[model samples]
Target: MFVKVVVVFLVMVGAALAFPHAPVQQPYYEQQPLMPYEFGFGVQDKYSGQNFGQRERSDGRAVVGSYSVDLPDGRRQTVNYKADKYQGFVADVSYTGQAHHPYH
Candidate 1:
């Protein structure tokens, strides 16, 4: 019983030292850009209405992405963009207010 207690104590100490005291929060958006390859998609944040999903072409000649962010005035803004060798770049933005709904 004494030996078991000592072993448990040692294990606990080892774990405490091996793991981080505060968990590291690396959002998916930040991680995607750091990868070796540039083609991927992820949602970086949700609560604040911030997220991005993007991808690059295999030939490296084009990229397409979309992102959304919440405004301070209780409105949400979204943007969609595309870039290619033929066309430099094009983007479209739309704003939606929480208080206004045309369909409803």
Candidate 2:
């Protein structure tokens, strides 16, 4: 019985060692220079790659929202937003490349 237990323990230890695990890398947010066509799953910005914007998808085939980005020429492009990453309510966005006035 003792030998069997030791053998089992050793087997488990060997298996664990053989299959070393790695800590998962969390998705990181990155910044990009102002440009065109940037997109992503959880963040938003100009320069289409990993900076489009973040969204949650919750329902059937689609998610919807909006975004905006500053053009290098100073004009801002306002865009609609939608994400298939999860499907749910996201946020609204608008762009104009001008400073926002906070009070009515």
On TM-score, the candidate that comes out on top is 1
Superposed by TM-score, candidate 1 places the C-alpha of residue 66 at a distance from the truth, in angstroms, of 0.7
| Candidate 2 TM-score, C-alpha based | 0.26
Best candidate per lDDT, number?
Answer: 1
Reference-based lDDT, each prediction: 0.68, 0.54
Could you give candidate 1's per-residue lDDT for residues 17-60 as a string of tens digits? 99978879798765553323355565766575555455444334
Write one digit per residue (lDDT tens) for candidate 2, span 20-87: 69987655522323222433454543465333334333244455545555454455666665654456
Off by over 4 Å in 1: 1-59, 99-104
Candidate 2's error at 11, in angstroms? Answer: 0.6
Clashes of each: 0, 18
Residues forming the 10-long window of minimal summed lDDT in candidate 1: 30-39
